[model samples]
Target: MRFVSWNVNGIRACVKKGFLDYFHKVDADIFCIQESKLQEGQIQLELEGYEQYWNYAERKGYSGTAIFTKIKPLSVSYGVGDLDTEAEGRIITLEFESFYFITMYTPNSKRDLARLDERLEWEDAIRTYLLQLEQVKPVILCGDLNVAHQEIDLKNPKSNRGNSGFTVEEREKMTKLLDAGFVDSFRYKYPEKTDAFTWWSYMSKVRERNIGWRIDYFIVSSSLADKIGDAQIHSEVLGSDHCPILLELEQ
Candidate 1:
Protein backbone atom coordinates (compact mmCIF):
# COMPACT_ATOMS: atom_id res chain seq x y z
CA MET A 1 0.00 0.00 0.00
CA ARG A 2 1.18 3.50 -0.86
CA PHE A 3 0.33 6.67 1.04
CA VAL A 4 1.20 10.17 -0.17
CA SER A 5 1.01 13.46 1.71
CA TRP A 6 1.45 17.03 0.54
CA ASN A 7 0.44 20.46 1.70
CA VAL A 8 -0.85 21.86 -1.58
CA ASN A 9 -0.66 25.36 -0.06
CA GLY A 10 -3.87 26.14 -1.91
CA ILE A 11 -5.53 23.43 -3.98
CA ARG A 12 -7.00 25.83 -6.55
CA ALA A 13 -3.72 27.55 -7.32
CA CYS A 14 -1.87 24.25 -7.26
CA VAL A 15 -4.18 22.77 -9.89
CA LYS A 16 -3.11 25.36 -12.42
CA LYS A 17 0.50 24.36 -11.84
CA GLY A 18 0.14 20.76 -13.00
CA PHE A 19 -1.25 19.31 -9.82
CA LEU A 20 -3.48 16.89 -11.72
CA ASP A 21 -0.60 15.74 -13.89
CA TYR A 22 1.48 14.80 -10.89
CA PHE A 23 -1.50 13.39 -9.09
CA HIS A 24 -2.23 11.05 -11.97
CA LYS A 25 1.38 10.06 -12.37
CA VAL A 26 1.85 9.18 -8.70
CA ASP A 27 -1.33 7.08 -8.54
CA ALA A 28 -1.25 6.73 -4.80
CA ASP A 29 -3.63 4.37 -3.01
CA ILE A 30 -4.30 7.13 -0.51
CA PHE A 31 -3.48 10.78 -1.20
CA CYS A 32 -3.72 13.39 1.57
CA ILE A 33 -3.46 17.16 1.12
CA GLN A 34 -3.44 20.06 3.57
CA GLU A 35 -3.84 23.83 3.38
CA SER A 36 -6.52 23.48 0.73
CA LYS A 37 -7.70 27.05 1.41
CA LEU A 38 -11.17 26.68 -0.04
CA GLN A 39 -14.76 26.15 1.05
CA GLU A 40 -17.40 23.64 -0.01
CA GLY A 41 -18.59 23.91 -3.64
CA GLN A 42 -15.58 26.02 -4.55
CA ILE A 43 -13.89 23.51 -6.87
CA GLN A 44 -14.64 20.03 -8.00
CA LEU A 45 -11.90 17.50 -8.76
CA GLU A 46 -12.61 14.55 -11.03
CA LEU A 47 -10.44 11.88 -9.48
CA GLU A 48 -11.24 8.59 -11.08
CA GLY A 49 -11.48 5.59 -8.72
CA TYR A 50 -10.90 7.68 -5.62
CA GLU A 51 -13.29 8.42 -2.77
CA GLN A 52 -12.89 12.06 -1.86
CA TYR A 53 -13.28 13.48 1.63
CA TRP A 54 -12.94 17.14 2.54
CA ASN A 55 -13.09 19.26 5.70
CA TYR A 56 -13.37 23.00 5.25
CA ALA A 57 -12.63 25.76 7.71
CA GLU A 58 -15.55 27.92 8.84
CA ARG A 59 -13.56 30.92 7.67
CA LYS A 60 -13.44 31.01 3.89
CA GLY A 61 -10.19 30.66 1.97
CA TYR A 62 -8.24 29.47 4.97
CA SER A 63 -6.91 26.23 6.46
CA GLY A 64 -8.44 23.01 5.14
CA THR A 65 -7.63 19.36 4.41
CA ALA A 66 -8.80 16.63 2.05
CA ILE A 67 -8.16 12.98 1.39
CA PHE A 68 -8.58 10.95 -1.80
CA THR A 69 -8.37 7.24 -1.39
CA LYS A 70 -9.04 4.34 -3.71
CA ILE A 71 -10.24 2.26 -0.79
CA LYS A 72 -13.39 3.41 0.96
CA PRO A 73 -13.11 3.71 4.72
CA LEU A 74 -15.42 1.87 7.10
CA SER A 75 -16.07 5.11 8.97
CA VAL A 76 -14.95 8.71 8.90
CA SER A 77 -14.70 11.63 11.32
CA TYR A 78 -14.11 15.39 11.01
CA GLY A 79 -12.23 16.81 13.97
CA VAL A 80 -10.18 15.97 17.05
CA GLY A 81 -12.78 17.19 19.53
CA ASP A 82 -15.20 20.06 20.23
CA LEU A 83 -12.40 22.62 20.38
CA ASP A 84 -11.39 22.23 16.71
CA THR A 85 -14.63 21.46 14.89
CA GLU A 86 -15.38 25.03 13.72
CA ALA A 87 -12.04 26.70 14.05
CA GLU A 88 -10.11 25.51 10.98
CA GLY A 89 -10.70 22.51 8.80
CA ARG A 90 -7.67 20.82 10.31
CA ILE A 91 -8.36 17.12 10.68
CA ILE A 92 -10.05 14.14 9.03
CA THR A 93 -9.98 10.57 10.36
CA LEU A 94 -10.91 7.47 8.43
CA GLU A 95 -11.23 4.05 9.93
CA PHE A 96 -10.37 1.07 7.79
CA GLU A 97 -10.57 -2.57 8.80
CA SER A 98 -6.93 -2.61 9.81
CA PHE A 99 -6.08 0.90 10.89
CA TYR A 100 -7.23 4.47 11.41
CA PHE A 101 -5.96 6.98 8.84
CA ILE A 102 -5.68 10.62 9.75
CA THR A 103 -4.75 13.75 7.84
CA MET A 104 -4.15 16.89 9.81
CA TYR A 105 -3.28 20.52 9.08
CA THR A 106 -1.79 21.59 12.35
CA PRO A 107 -2.27 25.20 13.39
CA ASN A 108 0.78 27.30 12.67
CA SER A 109 2.27 29.71 15.13
CA LYS A 110 2.20 33.06 13.38
CA ARG A 111 5.40 34.76 12.24
CA ASP A 112 5.42 36.83 15.41
CA LEU A 113 4.71 33.76 17.58
CA ALA A 114 1.34 35.29 18.43
CA ARG A 115 -0.44 31.96 18.11
CA LEU A 116 2.17 29.90 19.94
CA ASP A 117 -0.01 29.24 22.96
CA GLU A 118 -2.93 28.10 20.84
CA ARG A 119 -0.66 25.98 18.69
CA LEU A 120 0.75 24.28 21.78
CA GLU A 121 -2.75 23.65 23.07
CA TRP A 122 -3.65 22.13 19.73
CA GLU A 123 -0.62 19.83 19.87
CA ASP A 124 -1.67 18.57 23.27
CA ALA A 125 -5.22 17.95 22.14
CA ILE A 126 -4.14 16.17 18.97
CA ARG A 127 -1.64 13.98 20.80
CA THR A 128 -4.35 12.91 23.20
CA TYR A 129 -6.72 12.22 20.34
CA LEU A 130 -4.15 10.14 18.47
CA LEU A 131 -3.36 8.10 21.57
CA GLN A 132 -7.04 7.33 21.99
CA LEU A 133 -7.25 6.10 18.41
CA GLU A 134 -4.12 3.99 18.86
CA GLN A 135 -5.76 2.24 21.77
CA VAL A 136 -8.25 0.78 19.30
CA LYS A 137 -5.95 0.12 16.34
CA PRO A 138 -2.74 1.22 14.68
CA VAL A 139 -2.91 4.69 13.14
CA ILE A 140 -1.53 6.18 9.97
CA LEU A 141 -1.17 9.93 10.39
CA CYS A 142 0.04 12.37 7.78
CA GLY A 143 -0.01 16.01 6.54
CA ASP A 144 1.59 19.35 7.33
CA LEU A 145 2.37 18.90 10.99
CA ASN A 146 3.93 22.41 10.79
CA VAL A 147 6.98 21.80 12.96
CA ALA A 148 10.61 20.87 12.35
CA HIS A 149 11.30 18.43 15.16
CA GLN A 150 15.05 18.73 15.10
CA GLU A 151 17.97 20.84 13.93
CA ILE A 152 18.61 18.48 11.04
CA ASP A 153 15.10 18.98 9.69
CA LEU A 154 15.77 22.45 8.29
CA LYS A 155 18.51 24.51 6.72
CA ASN A 156 20.37 27.02 8.91
CA PRO A 157 19.01 25.46 12.04
CA LYS A 158 20.88 27.86 14.31
CA SER A 159 19.27 30.84 12.64
CA ASN A 160 15.84 29.25 12.52
CA ARG A 161 15.84 28.14 16.15
CA GLY A 162 13.06 29.57 18.29
CA ASN A 163 11.13 30.52 15.14
CA SER A 164 7.47 29.62 14.89
CA GLY A 165 7.88 26.08 13.63
CA PHE A 166 11.22 25.37 15.23
CA THR A 167 10.44 26.53 18.76
CA VAL A 168 11.44 24.18 21.58
CA GLU A 169 7.87 23.71 22.76
CA GLU A 170 6.62 22.76 19.29
CA ARG A 171 9.47 20.33 18.69
CA GLU A 172 8.98 18.77 22.12
CA LYS A 173 5.35 18.09 21.32
CA MET A 174 6.42 16.23 18.22
CA THR A 175 8.89 14.25 20.30
CA LYS A 176 6.12 13.40 22.71
CA LEU A 177 3.96 12.18 19.88
CA LEU A 178 6.70 9.87 18.65
CA ASP A 179 7.35 8.69 22.18
CA ALA A 180 3.70 7.69 22.34
CA GLY A 181 4.17 4.79 19.95
CA PHE A 182 4.38 6.61 16.61
CA VAL A 183 7.29 6.58 14.17
CA ASP A 184 8.19 9.17 11.58
CA SER A 185 8.56 6.94 8.55
CA PHE A 186 11.18 8.98 6.71
CA ARG A 187 13.60 9.32 9.56
CA TYR A 188 12.99 5.75 10.53
CA LYS A 189 14.30 4.75 7.10
CA TYR A 190 17.16 7.20 6.68
CA PRO A 191 18.25 8.13 10.14
CA GLU A 192 21.09 10.48 9.25
CA LYS A 193 20.20 11.78 5.79
CA THR A 194 20.51 15.56 5.64
CA ASP A 195 18.81 18.26 3.57
CA ALA A 196 15.66 16.20 3.02
CA PHE A 197 12.85 18.70 3.25
CA THR A 198 9.16 18.96 2.45
CA TRP A 199 8.17 22.64 2.77
CA TRP A 200 10.18 25.59 1.46
CA SER A 201 9.84 29.34 1.80
CA TYR A 202 8.48 31.10 -1.29
CA MET A 203 10.92 33.92 -0.80
CA SER A 204 13.34 34.62 -3.62
CA LYS A 205 15.92 31.86 -4.18
CA VAL A 206 14.84 30.03 -1.03
CA ARG A 207 13.42 27.01 -2.77
CA GLU A 208 16.18 27.23 -5.34
CA ARG A 209 18.74 26.92 -2.58
CA ASN A 210 16.79 24.14 -0.93
CA ILE A 211 16.30 26.15 2.22
CA GLY A 212 13.35 24.12 3.39
CA TRP A 213 11.84 22.51 6.45
CA ARG A 214 10.75 18.91 6.76
CA ILE A 215 7.44 19.84 8.39
CA ASP A 216 5.11 17.47 6.62
CA TYR A 217 5.29 13.79 7.60
CA PHE A 218 3.96 10.26 7.38
CA ILE A 219 3.71 8.94 10.91
CA VAL A 220 2.57 5.42 11.68
CA SER A 221 2.05 3.48 14.86
CA SER A 222 5.36 1.94 15.97
CA SER A 223 3.88 -1.50 15.53
CA LEU A 224 3.76 -0.83 11.79
CA ALA A 225 7.42 0.14 11.59
CA ASP A 226 8.64 -3.14 10.11
CA LYS A 227 5.84 -3.06 7.54
CA ILE A 228 7.22 0.21 6.13
CA GLY A 229 8.72 -0.55 2.73
CA ASP A 230 10.02 2.88 1.78
CA ALA A 231 9.80 6.57 2.57
CA GLN A 232 10.51 9.37 0.10
CA ILE A 233 10.66 13.11 -0.38
CA HIS A 234 9.62 14.23 -3.89
CA SER A 235 11.43 17.54 -3.74
CA GLU A 236 11.49 17.79 -7.52
CA VAL A 237 7.69 17.87 -7.84
CA LEU A 238 6.31 21.36 -8.05
CA GLY A 239 2.98 23.12 -7.37
CA SER A 240 2.91 24.31 -3.80
CA ASP A 241 5.79 25.53 -1.70
CA HIS A 242 5.55 22.05 -0.18
CA CYS A 243 6.29 18.89 -2.13
CA PRO A 244 4.85 15.43 -1.66
CA ILE A 245 6.28 12.81 0.71
CA LEU A 246 5.50 9.17 0.19
CA LEU A 247 5.32 6.05 2.33
CA GLU A 248 4.98 2.55 0.95
CA LEU A 249 4.09 -0.43 3.07
CA GLU A 250 4.44 -4.11 2.42
CA GLN A 251 1.30 -6.14 1.95
Candidate 2:
Protein backbone atom coordinates (compact mmCIF):
# COMPACT_ATOMS: atom_id res chain seq x y z
CA MET A 1 0.00 0.00 0.00
CA ARG A 2 1.15 3.54 -0.74
CA PHE A 3 0.48 6.62 1.35
CA VAL A 4 1.29 10.16 0.29
CA SER A 5 1.29 13.39 2.34
CA TRP A 6 1.73 16.99 1.33
CA ASN A 7 0.86 20.43 2.71
CA VAL A 8 -0.78 22.05 -0.29
CA ASN A 9 -0.58 25.62 1.17
CA GLY A 10 -3.96 26.26 -0.39
CA ILE A 11 -5.81 23.66 -2.42
CA ARG A 12 -7.21 26.24 -4.81
CA ALA A 13 -3.86 27.81 -5.61
CA CYS A 14 -2.16 24.44 -5.76
CA VAL A 15 -4.64 23.19 -8.33
CA LYS A 16 -3.63 25.91 -10.76
CA LYS A 17 -0.02 24.86 -10.29
CA GLY A 18 -0.62 21.31 -11.48
CA PHE A 19 -1.69 19.63 -8.26
CA LEU A 20 -4.14 17.45 -10.17
CA ASP A 21 -1.51 16.41 -12.68
CA TYR A 22 0.82 15.14 -9.98
CA PHE A 23 -2.08 13.73 -8.00
CA HIS A 24 -3.12 11.63 -11.00
CA LYS A 25 0.42 10.55 -11.75
CA VAL A 26 1.18 9.27 -8.26
CA ASP A 27 -2.12 7.40 -7.89
CA ALA A 28 -1.65 6.85 -4.19
CA ASP A 29 -3.77 4.44 -2.19
CA ILE A 30 -4.27 7.24 0.31
CA PHE A 31 -3.41 10.90 -0.17
CA CYS A 32 -3.34 13.32 2.78
CA ILE A 33 -3.00 17.08 2.63
CA GLN A 34 -2.64 19.89 5.15
CA GLU A 35 -2.92 23.69 5.10
CA SER A 36 -5.78 23.55 2.64
CA LYS A 37 -6.74 27.17 3.59
CA LEU A 38 -10.34 27.02 2.43
CA GLN A 39 -13.86 26.63 3.74
CA GLU A 40 -16.65 24.23 2.75
CA GLY A 41 -18.13 24.82 -0.72
CA GLN A 42 -15.17 27.01 -1.66
CA ILE A 43 -13.80 24.65 -4.27
CA GLN A 44 -14.82 21.26 -5.53
CA LEU A 45 -12.20 18.75 -6.65
CA GLU A 46 -13.19 16.12 -9.18
CA LEU A 47 -11.09 13.25 -7.99
CA GLU A 48 -12.06 10.03 -9.72
CA GLY A 49 -12.14 6.84 -7.65
CA TYR A 50 -11.17 8.58 -4.43
CA GLU A 51 -13.30 9.32 -1.39
CA GLN A 52 -12.70 12.89 -0.27
CA TYR A 53 -12.79 13.87 3.38
CA TRP A 54 -12.22 17.47 4.41
CA ASN A 55 -11.91 19.35 7.70
CA TYR A 56 -12.29 23.04 7.18
CA ALA A 57 -11.26 25.61 9.71
CA GLU A 58 -14.02 27.80 11.12
CA ARG A 59 -11.95 30.83 10.29
CA LYS A 60 -12.18 31.10 6.52
CA GLY A 61 -9.03 30.80 4.42
CA TYR A 62 -6.98 29.43 7.25
CA SER A 63 -5.51 26.11 8.37
CA GLY A 64 -7.32 22.96 7.17
CA THR A 65 -6.72 19.34 6.19
CA ALA A 66 -8.16 16.78 3.78
CA ILE A 67 -7.72 13.15 2.82
CA PHE A 68 -8.43 11.40 -0.45
CA THR A 69 -8.34 7.66 -0.35
CA LYS A 70 -9.20 4.98 -2.87
CA ILE A 71 -10.14 2.62 -0.09
CA LYS A 72 -13.10 3.69 2.00
CA PRO A 73 -12.45 3.66 5.71
CA LEU A 74 -14.58 1.64 8.10
CA SER A 75 -15.05 4.78 10.16
CA VAL A 76 -14.07 8.43 9.97
CA SER A 77 -13.45 10.93 12.74
CA TYR A 78 -12.57 14.60 12.94
CA GLY A 79 -10.23 16.15 15.49
CA VAL A 80 -8.95 14.82 18.82
CA GLY A 81 -11.39 14.92 21.70
CA ASP A 82 -12.62 18.51 22.21
CA LEU A 83 -10.39 19.81 19.44
CA ASP A 84 -13.25 19.77 16.96
CA THR A 85 -14.84 22.60 18.87
CA GLU A 86 -11.69 24.71 18.70
CA ALA A 87 -12.10 25.02 14.93
CA GLU A 88 -8.59 25.07 13.50
CA GLY A 89 -9.48 22.07 11.36
CA ARG A 90 -6.17 20.44 12.13
CA ILE A 91 -6.83 16.71 12.28
CA ILE A 92 -8.71 13.87 10.65
CA THR A 93 -8.65 10.20 11.66
CA LEU A 94 -9.81 7.26 9.57
CA GLU A 95 -10.13 3.76 10.85
CA PHE A 96 -9.57 0.88 8.46
CA GLU A 97 -9.79 -2.81 9.23
CA SER A 98 -6.09 -3.01 9.95
CA PHE A 99 -5.02 0.41 11.17
CA TYR A 100 -5.94 4.01 11.86
CA PHE A 101 -4.80 6.66 9.39
CA ILE A 102 -4.39 10.21 10.64
CA THR A 103 -3.55 13.42 8.84
CA MET A 104 -2.73 16.45 10.96
CA TYR A 105 -1.86 20.06 10.33
CA THR A 106 0.10 20.91 13.43
CA PRO A 107 -0.23 24.43 14.75
CA ASN A 108 2.84 26.46 13.98
CA SER A 109 4.39 28.56 16.70
CA LYS A 110 4.57 31.95 15.09
CA ARG A 111 7.96 33.41 14.10
CA ASP A 112 7.97 35.36 17.33
CA LEU A 113 7.28 32.20 19.30
CA ALA A 114 3.98 33.69 20.37
CA ARG A 115 2.12 30.42 20.05
CA LEU A 116 4.78 28.17 21.55
CA ASP A 117 2.80 27.30 24.65
CA GLU A 118 -0.28 26.33 22.68
CA ARG A 119 1.81 24.36 20.23
CA LEU A 120 3.42 22.41 23.06
CA GLU A 121 0.03 21.65 24.57
CA TRP A 122 -1.11 20.44 21.19
CA GLU A 123 1.87 18.11 20.92
CA ASP A 124 1.11 16.60 24.30
CA ALA A 125 -2.53 16.06 23.43
CA ILE A 126 -1.71 14.55 20.06
CA ARG A 127 0.88 12.18 21.55
CA THR A 128 -1.63 10.95 24.08
CA TYR A 129 -4.23 10.54 21.36
CA LEU A 130 -1.88 8.46 19.23
CA LEU A 131 -0.91 6.25 22.16
CA GLN A 132 -4.57 5.62 22.89
CA LEU A 133 -5.15 4.68 19.27
CA GLU A 134 -2.13 2.36 19.31
CA GLN A 135 -3.74 0.46 22.15
CA VAL A 136 -6.35 -0.63 19.62
CA LYS A 137 -4.31 -0.91 16.38
CA PRO A 138 -1.27 0.45 14.62
CA VAL A 139 -1.46 4.01 13.35
CA ILE A 140 -0.23 5.81 10.26
CA LEU A 141 0.36 9.47 11.16
CA CYS A 142 1.26 11.97 8.51
CA GLY A 143 1.13 15.63 7.38
CA ASP A 144 2.91 18.90 8.27
CA LEU A 145 3.99 18.26 11.83
CA ASN A 146 5.62 21.73 11.72
CA VAL A 147 8.78 20.89 13.60
CA ALA A 148 12.29 19.83 12.63
CA HIS A 149 13.10 17.10 15.14
CA GLN A 150 16.87 17.32 14.79
CA GLU A 151 19.78 19.21 13.30
CA ILE A 152 19.85 16.77 10.42
CA ASP A 153 16.32 17.75 9.43
CA LEU A 154 17.11 21.23 8.16
CA LYS A 155 19.77 23.35 6.53
CA ASN A 156 21.83 25.78 8.69
CA PRO A 157 20.72 24.11 11.89
CA LYS A 158 22.89 26.34 14.04
CA SER A 159 21.21 29.46 12.74
CA ASN A 160 17.74 28.00 13.13
CA ARG A 161 18.31 26.42 16.54
CA GLY A 162 15.93 28.59 18.53
CA ASN A 163 13.53 29.42 15.72
CA SER A 164 9.84 28.54 15.88
CA GLY A 165 10.08 25.10 14.32
CA PHE A 166 13.60 24.22 15.56
CA THR A 167 13.29 25.24 19.20
CA VAL A 168 14.74 22.79 21.72
CA GLU A 169 11.39 22.35 23.44
CA GLU A 170 9.63 21.54 20.17
CA ARG A 171 12.31 19.11 19.06
CA GLU A 172 12.29 17.37 22.43
CA LYS A 173 8.55 16.86 22.18
CA MET A 174 9.06 15.15 18.85
CA THR A 175 11.78 12.99 20.38
CA LYS A 176 9.46 12.05 23.22
CA LEU A 177 6.77 11.06 20.76
CA LEU A 178 9.16 8.81 18.82
CA ASP A 179 10.54 7.33 22.03
CA ALA A 180 6.97 6.41 22.88
CA GLY A 181 6.95 3.91 19.96
CA PHE A 182 6.53 5.72 16.65
CA VAL A 183 9.09 5.72 13.86
CA ASP A 184 9.80 8.49 11.40
CA SER A 185 9.83 6.48 8.21
CA PHE A 186 12.25 8.63 6.17
CA ARG A 187 14.94 9.08 8.80
CA TYR A 188 14.61 5.44 9.78
CA LYS A 189 15.36 4.46 6.17
CA TYR A 190 18.23 6.89 5.43
CA PRO A 191 19.73 8.19 8.62
CA GLU A 192 22.74 9.82 7.02
CA LYS A 193 21.11 11.27 3.94
CA THR A 194 21.21 15.08 3.96
CA ASP A 195 19.20 17.73 2.11
CA ALA A 196 16.08 15.56 2.19
CA PHE A 197 13.45 18.16 2.97
CA THR A 198 9.67 18.46 2.59
CA TRP A 199 8.95 22.17 3.26
CA TRP A 200 10.96 25.13 2.03
CA SER A 201 10.79 28.86 2.64
CA TYR A 202 9.25 30.80 -0.22
CA MET A 203 11.84 33.48 0.32
CA SER A 204 14.21 34.36 -2.50
CA LYS A 205 16.09 31.32 -3.80
CA VAL A 206 15.46 29.27 -0.67
CA ARG A 207 14.00 26.25 -2.41
CA GLU A 208 16.49 26.70 -5.23
CA ARG A 209 19.32 26.35 -2.73
CA ASN A 210 17.52 23.47 -1.00
CA ILE A 211 17.36 25.38 2.25
CA GLY A 212 14.38 23.46 3.54
CA TRP A 213 13.07 21.59 6.54
CA ARG A 214 11.69 18.08 6.73
CA ILE A 215 8.79 19.18 8.92
CA ASP A 216 6.28 16.92 7.20
CA TYR A 217 6.47 13.20 7.96
CA PHE A 218 5.01 9.72 7.84
CA ILE A 219 5.30 8.36 11.36
CA VAL A 220 4.00 4.87 11.93
CA SER A 221 3.62 2.75 15.02
CA SER A 222 6.91 0.95 15.77
CA SER A 223 5.19 -2.35 15.12
CA LEU A 224 4.85 -1.37 11.46
CA ALA A 225 8.53 -0.54 11.05
CA ASP A 226 9.42 -3.73 9.20
CA LYS A 227 6.47 -3.25 6.86
CA ILE A 228 7.95 -0.02 5.57
CA GLY A 229 8.95 -0.61 1.97
CA ASP A 230 10.01 2.83 0.68
CA ALA A 231 9.97 6.37 2.08
CA GLN A 232 10.54 9.16 -0.42
CA ILE A 233 10.63 12.96 -0.40
CA HIS A 234 9.14 13.96 -3.75
CA SER A 235 10.95 17.30 -3.85
CA GLU A 236 10.65 17.61 -7.59
CA VAL A 237 6.87 17.59 -7.64
CA LEU A 238 5.81 20.97 -6.45
CA GLY A 239 2.75 23.24 -6.03
CA SER A 240 2.99 24.61 -2.54
CA ASP A 241 6.16 25.50 -0.65
CA HIS A 242 5.95 21.94 0.65
CA CYS A 243 6.41 18.88 -1.54
CA PRO A 244 4.81 15.47 -1.32
CA ILE A 245 6.32 12.62 0.71
CA LEU A 246 5.51 9.04 -0.08
CA LEU A 247 5.52 5.94 2.10
CA GLU A 248 5.06 2.48 0.62
CA LEU A 249 4.32 -0.53 2.76
CA GLU A 250 4.96 -4.16 1.97
CA GLN A 251 1.71 -5.96 1.39
lDDT of 1 by residue, 76-110 (tens): 99997766555688899999999999999988899
How would you encode candidate 2's per-residue C-alpha lDDT over 119-238 as one tens digit per residue? 999999999999999999999999999999989999989999899999999999999999999999998899999999998988999999999999999999999999999999999998
CA displacement after TM-score superposition, residue 88 of candidate 1 (Å): 0.8
What is the clash count for each candidate, in the order shown?
0, 0
After TM-score superposition, the amount by which residue 157's alpha carbon in candidate 2 deviates from its true location, in angstroms, is: 0.5
Model 1 lDDT at residue 146: 90
Clashing pairs in 1: none
lDDT of candidate 2 at residue 198, scale 0 to 100: 91
Q: lDDT per prediction?
A: 0.94, 0.94
**Candidate 2 segments whose C-alpha is farther than 4 A from its true place:** 84-86
How does residue 100 of candidate 1 score in lDDT? 96
Worst 10 residues of 1 by lDDT: 80-89
Report residue 214 deviation for candidate 1 (angstroms).
0.5
